[model samples]
Target: MGAWFTHLILQLAAILGSSLVTPTPLVRTDSGAQLERDWGQQVRLKHLYMEGNSRHLQINPDGHIDSSHAQNFYTLLEIKAVERGQVVIRGVNTDQYLCMDTEGNIFGSTTYREDDCNFNEEQLETFYNVYHSPRHKKVLSLSLEKRPYIPNRELPPLSMFLPRENELPMATYSRRSSERETNDTDPFGMRSGQQASPKLSRSSRG
Candidate 1:
């Protein structure tokens, strides 16, 4: 019985030690795979181009949203994931959050109001995706005539936008520090002194 108890004690200690060890956390790098990738990163939304009506979600310095011309500086925005299928849009240049009022007024504000700014981001069967204000049942559209306020049922072609990478995502434009903690232990997220495999990513289906 004493030998059995001793063996049981060692087994329990081994289990406890394993539990204390932290597993590698899944990281979303710039070259992250689809399943591994997540939002809360900066991206640009580009609408279908027309001669007079090229639209991009641009925030003015005074906390106003414009869908007119694609302003290089102001068109960069960040989509932060709040919960599944929900996100909040914020302007990278103006430091403002994109919001929609119940009266169908689309604007940007320095303050973030959860209800006003929470939007449902969904990818369509096609190449484009859409942002809809679920609370107000309004679609954030970029129509040439009346912008950012179409009924969700209408589903205008211009309302959908293609996600694009920021051309010049500099540290100067961001609030966060430029420093990313180096993984001295294992930059490849594994044990050291082994043959490095080719950088891998999961190809996402369209």
Candidate 2:
């Protein structure tokens, strides 16, 4: 009877230990819609101008600028570095444009268009291939004219420029975990302390 009771207690302790040691599974909702929403939220549209010509620019899904002149004049929108390349131009009007480099050199104006319309992905890619090719390094370094303009009214903040869908929550898991941790740590403000265990001294060891 004594051995059976000891074994039952040991089994219960083992089961409890295992349950305490196991980690809880992390659950995640559909991230595809979240990703799409985040991407759309980061999209920024701007108007670019060079040499008295202006065009509306949109940041494409691939993170490249879809310049209004992309289809008609691809050479003008060629970017050097794929990662850090950002389409920079003087506001919606005024001519004098250049492709800004990571090193701060603004390459000269390569193309110009009167109408600010019909720019798309296909045209941007074609232009990127032709003028930005390895063999065209010399043309990429040319200096273009520069024009400056001030906005008539204060431009809205960048956050306001983002689409509405992107404004939705993007980080649900972290938020949920944070809330859970907050609740678990001090649910009732109960004090946590260490329990004392009697220690044997050298003199008492004998």
Best by lDDT: 1
Q: Per-residue lDDT of 1-206 in model 2, one digit per residue for the tens?
A: 99999999999999999988969788766455334322222222222232213332333322233344332222222211111221222111112233333232232221221111101111121122111212112112122422221223221111011111112233642353355334443321112201221222222111
| Clash counts for the predictions, in order | 0, 6
Backbone clashes in model 2, listed as residue pairs: 50-95, 50-96, 51-95, 51-96, 52-95, 108-144
Candidate 2 lDDT score at position 12: 100
- RMSD to the hidden true structure, all candidates: 16.9, 28.4
Model 2 ranges with Cα > 4 A deviation: 20-98, 102-206
- Tens digit per residue, CA lDDT, model 1, 114-160: 66678887765664667778777677764533334343444744567
lDDT of 1 at 86: 77
**Native-to-model Cα distance after best TM-score fit, residue 118 in candidate 2, in Å:** 23
Error of 2 at 23 (Å): 0.7
Kindly report which residue stretches of model 1 are placed more than 4 angstroms away from their true locations once superposed: 1-37, 40-53, 68-71, 144-153, 174-206
